[model samples]
Structure formats: C-alpha cells, structure tokens
Target chain A: MQAQTQRYSVLMVDDDPEDGVLVQKAIASSGPKVDFQFVASGAEVLDYLFTEGRFTDRSSAPRPNLILLDLNMPGVDGFSVLKQIKSDMDLRRIPVVVLTTSEAETDIVKSYDFGANTFITKPSSFSDMIEVMTSLKSYWFDAARLPTA
Target chain B: MLAIYEYLFGAASFVPHGYCLAWRPDLIAIHALSDGVIALSYFSIPIALILLLNKREDLAFKRTFGLFALFIFSCGVTHLTAMIMLWEPYYGAQGMVKAVTAMISVVTAISLWPLLPKVLALPGPGQLRKMNTQLAAEIAEKNAAQVNLHQAYQQVEAQVVERTRELQALNQRLQDDVRRRSLLEEELREKAAQLIATNAELERFAYIASHDLQEPLRKIQAFGDLLKSEYETVLPDEAVEYVRIMQNAAYRMNKQTKDILTLSRLSWDSIQFDSLDLAEVVEEVAFDLKERIEEAGGKLEVGPLPGIPGDRTQIRLLMQNLLVNAFKYREPDSIPEVHVEATLHDTGAPGTGGACVEISVRDNGIGFAQEDAERIFSIFQRLHGRSEFDGTGIGLAICKKIVENHNGAIEAVSSLGKGAVFNIRLPTSQPERREIHAGTDTAV
Candidate 1:
C-alpha cells in the first residue's frame, strides 16, 4: 500500500550496468520518494529478497513493493527467480514487472505465464523510457490499489 | 543209203553252168554277167546293213539288227554259190549254201515274231515330241516358282535387317535416358548436401545476430541516449550532435541485425498455418500503423479479401512491412495512398493448378525503376540513401520470405515515376508440412 509519509521501494535485477543506470535515472525522474534498488545478477536478487548472504541483516534488506526483472542473465536467470518468487507464499503477493531488451513474443508469453504482472520491452530512446517509467509510477502508485506490506 | 551218202560227198556232178546253157556264146555271157552282178549286189547290201548297225549302236533292237545282218550274209553266200554253180556245176556245195541260208532265215523269223510286240510298244516320233514339250512347260513353271520363293526370302531378310536396326536405335535412346536421369540424381544429392550445410550456417548467423550482436549495440545506444538526455546542457552543441549521430548509428545497426535475425528465422522456423481472413489481418496491420499513416497524412483503402492458410504472426509482419514501405517511399508533398485488394483465382478445377488468392498492394507513392523490381526483393538492396529514406532495405525481402513461407509467389510491376503494384499469390490451402532437420543445440 502507498502512504504519503512512507517511501515505496522498487528492486530491479539486470546484468547490464548501462541498462541499470538508465532505468535508475528514469525511476529517479519519475518519483522523488521511490527507493529504487539494483542487483547485478539473479543470485544477488535472490540474496536481497530472502535477506541472506550479504543482505542477511533485516534492516539492510528492505522488502520491495515491486520487482523489475530482466529475463536474460548470466546465472540463475530471471525466469528461475520469477518462478521461485511466485511459488514462495511470502513473496508471491509482491508485483513483478518483466523488463528486457528482447521483444521476442516467446519471452513476453513466458513472462506472463510465470505470473509476471506486466511485460515491457526496454525502449531505445531516453524520452520513451521516461514515458514508460512515468506511466508505471502513475498506474502502480496513484491509480491501482495494492495490499499493505 | 551208202550210194546216196557217196553221191552227196563225191564231185560226180561237177559241170560248168555254160554247158548247161548248150555252149551258146551269148547265153553263157548273159548268165555269167547276171550271176556276178547279183553276187556283188548281195555282198554290198550286207556291208551296208553292218555299217548301219555299227553307226546306230544305242538302237533299242541291237540283237534284232545282229540277227538281220547274219541272215543277209548267209543269203549273200548262197547267191555267190549260185554264181559258182554257173561256172563249174558244183551242185552239192550250192545245195549246202542254200541249206545254211534256209536255216538262218528260219531262226530270224522265229526271233522276229517274239520282238514284234516290243517293237510296236516303242513310242512314235510324234508322241515323243509331245512328251518333250510337256516336260519343258513343267520345268519352266518350277523355275518361275523357285525364283519367286527366292525373292520372298530376300524381302523377309531385308525386313529383319531393318527391324534389327530400329530396335538398336531404341535401345540406344533408352540407355541415354537412363544415363541422363542418373546424372540428374547425382546433382540433386549434391544440392541436398549443400543445403544442409547452408542451413546450419544460417542458424549460427541468426543466433549471433539476435543476442551477441544486438547486445553491444543496445548498450551503445542506451549510453548515448543517457548522455544526450542527462548531459546535453553541459556538453557543447557539437558534442550533443556527435552523441545523436552515435545513437542513430547504433539504432540503425540494431534494426539491421533484427531484420537479419527475422530473415534467418524465417528460413528455419517451423510454421503452423491457420485459416485466416486476410481482410481482418490487413485491417489489424492498418490499425497498428494508424499513427504513422496519420503522421504522413496517408490514406489506406482495403478491398474484399479471401481466407487463406498462413502463419498468423508472419502474415501480420508481412502486411506491416509492405504498408510501411509504401508510405516510406512516398513522393515529397504528396499524400501516401495505399490500397489493398484481393482476387480469387479458382484454378483448382484442373487438379494440376491450385486455387489461390491474388492479393495486390498498390501504392500511389514514388515507385522504383522498372528494372529494379526484382532487385528490390533482395535483402539489404537499398534503392536510396539513408538520408533520403530511412530504411534498412530488408522490408521487401522479409515480405518475399513470408510469402514464400506460405508457399506463395510475389511479383512487383511498375514503371518509373508510376505507382507500384505488389501482387502476392497465396494458395487457399496449406501444403503438407515438411519436417526440417533441427540445427545444433548451441544455436538459439
């Protein structure tokens, strides 16, 4: 749930630094209070989500309200991460958005099949990316209702 | 009896024939001359008979002729005896000669009587001549028949020789046909092997294009976009322009790789065909391109279309590329007008011909040169520079591949400066799907 005083959190898992930074900038531009977090690999995302390994301290690993996932990763790919998150009762309630460079139909269908809330192909232009971020923020933060964390 | 025997042997009757004529000179002379002439005549007749018998030795009655000769000689001896009797009265000798002649005459008569029927049975000269003529006629007829038989045999031999020659020629042609067919089979086998190798290579290329090649290009574009969006104010106008150019290059490369990937995928992907209304497909394509069309101030007119069997996604891409190409190549300061229409050609009444739908995409845009119609449907074949028309030059090639994927044909007809028409012929029914050999596992 969105509250005026509490800042919402978002987590993105991507292997590419360039894509991560661009999405970070877009998220920053879209919302001032959004706590956007970046994990470089699927393993790190799992670590951060379960509060294990380097993120073992409960205070350091804040549970995210939404997850932005990239399907192609070096090890423990986004599909496996998505499957694990959706199957876990504690993590299943969190919304997942699949964002990837691939515009392949198979990827889109598979992402939805794995219980992803939305699928977005990564826009090439900064302006288009900003638009996607703005609309995502408006829909998730302002229009649609979510269960309280 | 003793006195008679003595009288027969003794010369007591020895007397001259002249004394018997009473010693007259004229009478004696006449008797002697007549007897001498008669004797000479009788000897000459026997000699002539002997000569006749010797000359005609093949005569049928040779024994009869010998008997006749003997009888004549004996009679001659008797006549000579008479002549002697006229000179010297040797009556006993004369009687003996007459007796021998009488005996020979009696034997000749007996032999002649038995030979009479045989001599009568011998053919006459006229009958012999008639038989010779008949034999000659029969011989002539047999000779003519023999000649005819020989000619017929020759004609049959000639025909056999001719038929043998014809059979030999037919065998030669059949052997040549077999050899040609074997050569064709060998060529086909080699082509099949080459196709396998080429398909493998295409699959490798598609994997590289889809993932590895697009990766760095995407990064380059993303960073360039960031620089332009975030640091444009701090950067000089020239720097900003450089960034924009770099992004544009990266974008174009990405698009080119994507198109290459699509073309490669079309080659090896398994297609599942569905019964689709082509009108609905075209309408969907038009709706997706609505904003672009409105931006170009274009008008799209769709006519009635038939249902055909095709891959839905591929067909959608095919229509999208065609419409975009029509609008992209439009003349400056003119509204882009694209028309989509289809006509059914039910040629399946004859089983050899397939019923098909001929869909034509006509555009009132800047058409290409007539000679370049075939070249336009080849990948990366650009008709204009990038600045003149923003294109990767793979749209028509993709269209061609899509049409071919549906087991169809496509052709473009146009003149320079005239509107172009792209005619696509698609069968109403899909052909049986052939199983393609899977590529290497490493390929994406």
Candidate 2:
C-alpha cells in the first residue's frame, strides 16, 4: 500500500470509546500501513487538530489527512466540527467522512451540506465495518488524489 | 139723567154727519170707503204682527211688539167710527178708542228706546260670512296636517317591518354560524382526543428509542462478529454456534431498536407535505432493491401510477417497505413476482371529498391467514416465526402511520395459499390546504 511510504493518519471523533476501538480494529484489518487515532469527544477533535489543551505536544499530535466524525456527541457535535473545519483554510482540505449510527435523511443531507466528503451509516457487523474501511482505504489512499503534505 | 146718557152713548142728540154734507153721495162714499180700507189694513197688520210674534218667540222685546199691535187696533176702531159717522155719528166710541191707542203707543215707544242698541250690537250677515270663510280655511289646514301625520305613521310602520325582517335575517345567519362553529369545535375535540391517545403511544416509543439500548446491542453484534472473524480458528464448533446465536440475537435486537426509532421519529417530527410522483418513488425503491430482486429472480411490474400530495420521504419509505415485504415473504420455490398499479378513485370522505389514487402492491408470497391481515398493521406485530422470515415487524405499522399522516387509508388482504395484496389510498389533492404537524411537540 502507498500508506507505507507516506504514513497517513486518520482521526476519528466519537463520544463512545468502544466505537473508536471497533473502528481502529476495522482500519487494522483494512491495511497495516494506515495509522489510526481516536478522540473521545467533538471538542477534543479541535484540541487534537490545533494542538491545544491536552494535545499540546507537537510531535505526538499530528494533523490528520482524514477525519471520521460521529454526529451524536455530548457537545460540539459533528455538524459544528464539520462547519469549523470546512471554513478554516488549513483544515478544509482534510476529507471528512461522517460515520454515524443515524440513518436519518436530515443527518445525511446536513452532513453533505456542511461539506462532508462522505456519509456512511455505522454497520453493526465487524465484517461490514472491515469492508467499509477497506473500500474507504482503497478509494481515499489508492484511487483519489489528495493535497500533498 | 138723559143728558148724561147721551154723552155716554153719543149719536142721540146729534144729526147724522150725512146731513151736514147736504147728502152729497160722492163725498159720503169717499169718506166711508177710505175709513173702511184703513181699518181693514190696521186690523190685518195687528194680526200679522201677532203671528210674527208667535213664530219668533225668541225675538228681543216681545212685549213692545204686543203693545204696538194693540195701538194699531185702537187706531182701526177710530177709523171704523169715522166710516160709521159717514152714515150715523159714533164720536164717543171713537174718543174712547183713541185714548186706549195713545196709552199703548207711549208704552211701545218707551220699550223701543232701550232695545235699539241691542239690535245694533248683533253681528251682520257679511261679517258672519267672513268669519265662516276663515273657520273653513283653518279646518282645511288641520285636515292636511292630519294627512301628513298619517303618512309619517305609515312610514314608521314600514321601517319597523323592514328592521324586523333584517334582524330576523341576521339572527338566521348567526344561527348558521353557531352551528358551523359547533361542528368545527366538535371535530377539534375529537382530534384532541386522538392526539392525546397518540401522544401516549409516542411517549413509549420515545422511551424505547432514547434508552441507549442500540449502542450496547451494536457492540454485542460487532464483538460477536469479531469473535467469529478472529477467533474462529481456535474456537470449538459449539462455541462457534454460540457466537452465531449471540450475533443473531443482537442483530435482531438492533433491528428492533432501529425500527422503534423510526416509529418514534414519525411521531416526533413534523412531516413535510409535497407533490410527489408515486411512480418515481416506486422506481427509486425498485432500483434500491435491484440486487435482492435479481438474486431472487423476481419480476416487479410497475403500471401507471398517479401523482399525489404527501410527504415525499415518508411515501418513499412506504413504497420501499411494501416492496421489501413482497421480496422478503416469498415462497421458497416460486419466483417472486410483484405488481405495482394505481387507479383513480373517490375518497368519499365526509367534509373531505376529493379524488384519491389507489395503489395496489400484489406479491406472490407466503401469504398469511385472512384474520391476521388487520393485525399485521399493528406495531411489532408479526404472524410468521422469526426463524421463518427476517423482519422486526414494524414495516406495515409504519406504512399505516404514513398513510394516516397523509389523511389517507391503507389495507392488506391475504389468504393461506393465495398471494398478499397491499392497497394504499392517497388523496390527489389536500382539502383546505393547512400544514399538518403530526406527533408530539418534542423531537425524539
């Protein structure tokens, strides 16, 4: 995979720590090259991206090339994060894929309207999650062009 | 004694007056005729005066007229004595009569002096005529004023009648308005009752959806999948079966939670009504289920459908659910064949009369008994065993709710061997275009 030569880090934002672990496993099953990172809340996403608060270490907290966002969080929801990311010049280039358990039309449309690159319903099965991650990996890392870091 | 008697009787000592005239026949005759005519006129005048006095008893000074008549009678006796002396002297009797006439004339003259002023004070005929003319003019004016007053009374009467009629009309209109408002109020009361009952049901659904159950259920399914995928090589066959069972149970529970959320959303959110082409909706659903249909070797024939007023998302879901049911409940051997068709029909709903589109979805599937047709639309109601068919059993219930939100009707008909048919009726046009907000005020 091209991720071996160019290490790509993906950040996932969710309030549920278990969903973060499951997604990390799925990413591992998809490929060995891609690095997976996690944040527990939407507010922590900004901290990790801007190197603020607990994420002040420059070397430890790197800018992610992609962001996986969950819509139903306690505070600073996915929509507000998407809006802030899309509005910022430095963060707008990072592709955001909304992976939430909501299959609501309003959520999907709102996610896309807020400049989400993709909207995916979180699958229940581990195999389905692996399939989603594999396709996402092949599409974003292999097929699609991205801004050079 | 003889002298005294001759003075009283007169004519005994005197020769006749005819002798003094040398017995001239012409002179005698003239004196006698003149005196006789004068006496006759005086007597007739007294009689006429008496008759006048008797007829006019109301005349002023009646005693004066009687005295004047007596004086004239005495003068007539004197004249008769003159006529008698033309032949034989009657001088004594004439003197006595003259004395009586004098007395009566004096009395009449005295009475006339006082009565003259009273007779002059009486109104004359010309002045009375002028007064009568003035009285006639005043009476005419009074009559004209009476006529005007009568006309005014008539006008007032007409106005009263007109006002009464107007009030009656206004009262009738008010009565009609009251009846209409009462009917509307009755309908609102019924709707409020239904809302109360529906709100109670929605509360339960909301509780289930918001219970944080799906998260744990999803984790269970995902961990179960992970065990099978990662630890299958080390696990025994029995452990593998146990993992599979746990995954199936979790998957079913996850589906139930998702279905509950869908039901709660229907009761929590305001649905948007729009003009929707149902044929296009069916095409989209068929395209979405294309793989399933091809895998089953099924045929979905869509006939001409109608455009109806409904919530687009809900109507799309309705079509998807019905078609998915047809594909899901198919017999094992038979090729799944589903026909989608529509017809224009009248809803004939009271106060909501309009045309509706009747869409039927007939599927060659494992049909349920006729009795379970109505029960299938209930929430979480399932006729077949969970092992036989894969469903959370809320699809038909959602369909029924969607139809109700559109103010439409939906029904299902099926027998044991025969195929099942789902008929949905949607109004072509909404009556009295008011925005409808279904469910509770709070969003789930």
Candidate 3:
C-alpha cells in the first residue's frame, strides 16, 4: 500500500527560521515520507504560488499538494495571501492549513472565513510538535485524498 | 283873648306866598324825570351787585359788597320819595324820607372809610390776568417735568424688561450646557463600563489559554520521562543527562504556567461569598500543613478568630499560602513558631461602620528587608536563590489575589534578620448594604 501511494508535497510559510527547522525536525522524526518546502515571507509564498520571478519554471517550482500558512508576517500578511489563493480559480482547490501561535477565536474564525482547510495552534514543546506533525501527516497524506494537479 | 285869636288866623294866611310862587309844568316834569332816572340807575346797580354776589357765592369779601349795595339802594329810595313829593306835596312825609336817607348816607360814609383800604387792596382785573398767566406758566412747567419723569420711568422699565430677557436666555443656555454635560458624563460612564468588561474578557481568555498551554508542557515532561526510563540502555550518558535536564525544565515551565493560570482564574466572576469563621479555616490549614510543620519542627498557635465575609475556598487557599510560607521561611537552628490570631478591626470603609476582622499570621522566619515587603507579593519574585528556598515565588502573590477576591487587603511588615507578620483584613459583613440587598434579591 505504501509503495502504491503517491508522495505528497507541502509548502510551509513561516518567518521564524527556528520554528521552520523545528517543524522539519519533527516531521523527519515521525511524519510520512513527503516533500517539504519552506518560505520565510507571505510575499515569497505568493511568488512561489504564482510562479513569478525566480519561480517561473514550473518543473523547478512544482505546485504543492498542501500549504501550511502562518498568520502574522512582516508584509502581505496571511489573510491577504489566503484571500488571493482562495479567490483564484486555479489555486482555490489546493488545501491550506493555518498553523499559528494565536489561540484567539477571532483568528480561528477568520482563518475559516478565508477557506482554510484546517486550523491548529502551534505546540510549545518539541515532543508535542512531533505529535501534532505526526497526526497532521496521517490525516492529510494517508486518510484524505488530494486533488490532482 | 280877642288879640290871640287874631294872631293864629294870621299864621294860616302865610301859605299865600307859595301860591304866589309860579306853578311851571316844564320845571316840574324835568325835575321828576331827572329824579326817576337817578333812582332807577341806583336801584338797578344794587340789584346787579346782589345778583353777581349770589351767583358767585365763593367771591371774596361778600358781606362788604352786600353792605355797599344796601347803602346805594337806600340813597335811591330817598330819591324815590323826592319824586313822590313832586306829585303830592306832603312836606312831613318828604322830610321824614330825607331824614332816613341822611342816616343811611352817614352810615355808608363811615363804613366806606373803614373798607376803603380793603377795597383798594383787592386786585384789579388786569392784575388778576397777570397772576393767572404766571400760574399757568408754572403749571405748564410742572406738566413738562412730569412728562420727562414719566419718560424716564418708561425707559427704566424697558431696560429692566430687556435685562430680564437676557437673563432668561442665559439661564436657558446654562440649562442646555448642564444637560449636555450630564449626557456626556453618562456616555463616559458607559464607555468605562465597557472597557471594564473587555478587560475581564481578556483576563478570562488568558486564563483559558494558559490552562491549555499546560497540556503540551505536561506531554513533553511525560515523554521525556518515557525516553529516560525506556531508553536507558540505548541512550548514551550525556544524552540521558540532556533528557533529564529537558524534563526538569519542562516541569518548571509547567509549574510557572500553572501559577499563571491560577493568577488569571482568580478574577473569575463565579466566586461565592459566605460568612466563614477564621478559626475553622486556620484549623484546616494547620491540618493540611501538619506533615510539613512536623518536618520543620514548627509549632502553630491558633488563637480565637472572628467570623468574616469571604469566599471559603479562596480564603482557605489564602490561609494555606500564608501558613506554608511561615513554615518554609524558617530561620536555621530556630524551631519554627507561627501564631495565628484574629481580632476585630475598623476598616474605615464607607458605610460599613468600620466593622472588620484582622487576622495576623506571625512567624519566626528568615524575614526579608522592609523594602522587599511589597515586592514579595509580586508573582515569581524571589529574594533568595532557588537552591536556598524551594518556591515558584507565586505563593504570596496568590495569597494577595485570593484576599483581594474577598474584597480584603493583605500587608507584610518585616526587617532583615527579624520575624515577619502577614496581616489580612476582611470586612465582617459586606461593606455596601444596598449592593448586598440587591444581590440577594436578584439572586433569588
């Protein structure tokens, strides 16, 4: 079953390098074998999604199966990015999960309003991070079916 | 006798001379007409004077004018008799009338002499006209002055009316301003109430978040323990030490977060206040702290305590925190001795009539500096290192928060190397009677 399954790709958007590294480490430890990409800014996420500038080549910048979005960023913010992605016909079908440190109900509601597939609070400890990543991998890669590109 | 008779007869014969005097008709007619005209003029004058006097009863000197008229009439009557004699030649009658006229003439002359000065003093018509003109001028002047005075009075009345109108307008503006100010004040009060509610909501959110945050930390500690125990042989010594250190750090973090949660939850609105005896609360705390106290070789002396209005659970927590602190901060080589006592106090809060209970927990412990007395009640504040005293440093802060939840106050006074006393003051009854009544009435 594992050999027959197609490997999934995930684009992670976060400004904190340490958090990105921690996620990478946690996923490596407990998650499925999947491709991972990291972007530091919401602008970079948008550039990569639109295949603009340096990401003009479709083969080098393949569209990911899922997007892990962070809310607070220096510029272009998560809500704007989410709005852009959901409004566009080509990108609206791709699943976007909001992973943020905010436990505010407003943030959760707003994420759903922008067509976020999932909303999750970032775990504080490394072991909890690992557990959350394992659950996320299991649910997204193994249980749910993804749309073909 | 014959000679006397002859003489008398000769006297009768003497009138024969009158007969010899010529009987001229012209002379007789002229004399009669003259006398009649004189008499008529004199009598008419007196009648006119009388009539003038009667019409003008208020005329000055009326009696004098009457006497003057009567004298002139009497002179006219004498003339009337003389005219009668012209027709009848009755000498004796004529003579008698003449005598009466003479007497009237004499009286008139005498009276006229006395009244002459007064009659002359009477003003003439020309002089009276002059006086009338002067009086008329004086009256005209007075009328003009009165007109001017009336005009001035009217002007003053108009000014008063205008001033009253201005005052009324000003009063209206003042009322409007007052109304607007009151409205603004009411709106401000509403905004302040909203701000308070928002702050409370934020506090609740913080409490819940912190509580949820503890779960991941617990998991970390639990898994770290699992790794340490289960992989003891597989893990290297340094790796094992790192895991243990991570577990210790996670445990400390968990403790701090829990304290934060407690601090946040202290503001929860569901606390119930009831009348509680401090003696009972102290006894319970003593029993809870019995093992610790025995290990520290401490003795707790509880005196009589008064009943106070408070939340029972919070007050119990307050007593436990203070009692534990008393046992925890004991001086080395000195047996820990703590005294719990309560007395009636005057809180001086408005409307409560200063009825309160002051509970003091005193201990022979390693007291802090006087300046740090206030600092000790801040969360996580520590005077000594963790190795010196085992505490998260949130105990006193929790105590303070709990006491505050009951609308009470707590204070500590201590000097370095001396003992410390923690005093808690709580009202014996709710301070605001109206609020209590409202709460109870609405609660039902």
> After superposition, which runs of candidate 2 have C-alpha atoms over 4 Å from their true positions?
A1-4, A75-89, A104-116, B1-211, B346-354, B432-434, B438-444
lDDT of each: 0.84, 0.84, 0.78
What's the fnat for candidate 2, on a 0 to 1 scale?
0.41
lDDT of 1: 0.84
Q: Note the residue pairs that clash in candidate 3.
A: none
User: On a 0 to 100 scale, what is the lDDT of residue B353 in model 1?
Assistant: 66
What local lDDT score does residue B201 receive in model 1, on the 0 to 100 scale?
83
Per-residue alpha-carbon lDDT of candidate 2 for residues B315-384, written as tens digits (9 for 90 to 100) = 9999999999998897777899999999987754223667778889999888889899899999989888
Native contact share for candidate 1:
0.32
Docking quality tier of candidate 1? Answer: incorrect
* Interface RMSD (Cα, Å) for model 2: 3.9
Q: How many pairs of residues collide in each model?
A: 1, 0, 0
What TM-score does model 3 achieve against the real structure?
Answer: 0.54
Model 3 ranges with Cα > 4 A deviation: A1-149, B1-42, B53-75, B86-190, B193-197, B225-245, B267-273, B345-356, B401-409, B425-444
> lDDT (0-100) at residue B382 of candidate 2?
88
Model 3 agreement with the true structure over B102-150: per-residue lDDT tens digits:
8877877787797878878999999999999999999999999999999
B340-420 per-residue lDDT for model 1 (tens digits): 999888863123368888888999888988899899999989989999999898889999988888878888988867889
CAPRI-style quality class for the chain A–B interface of candidate 3: incorrect
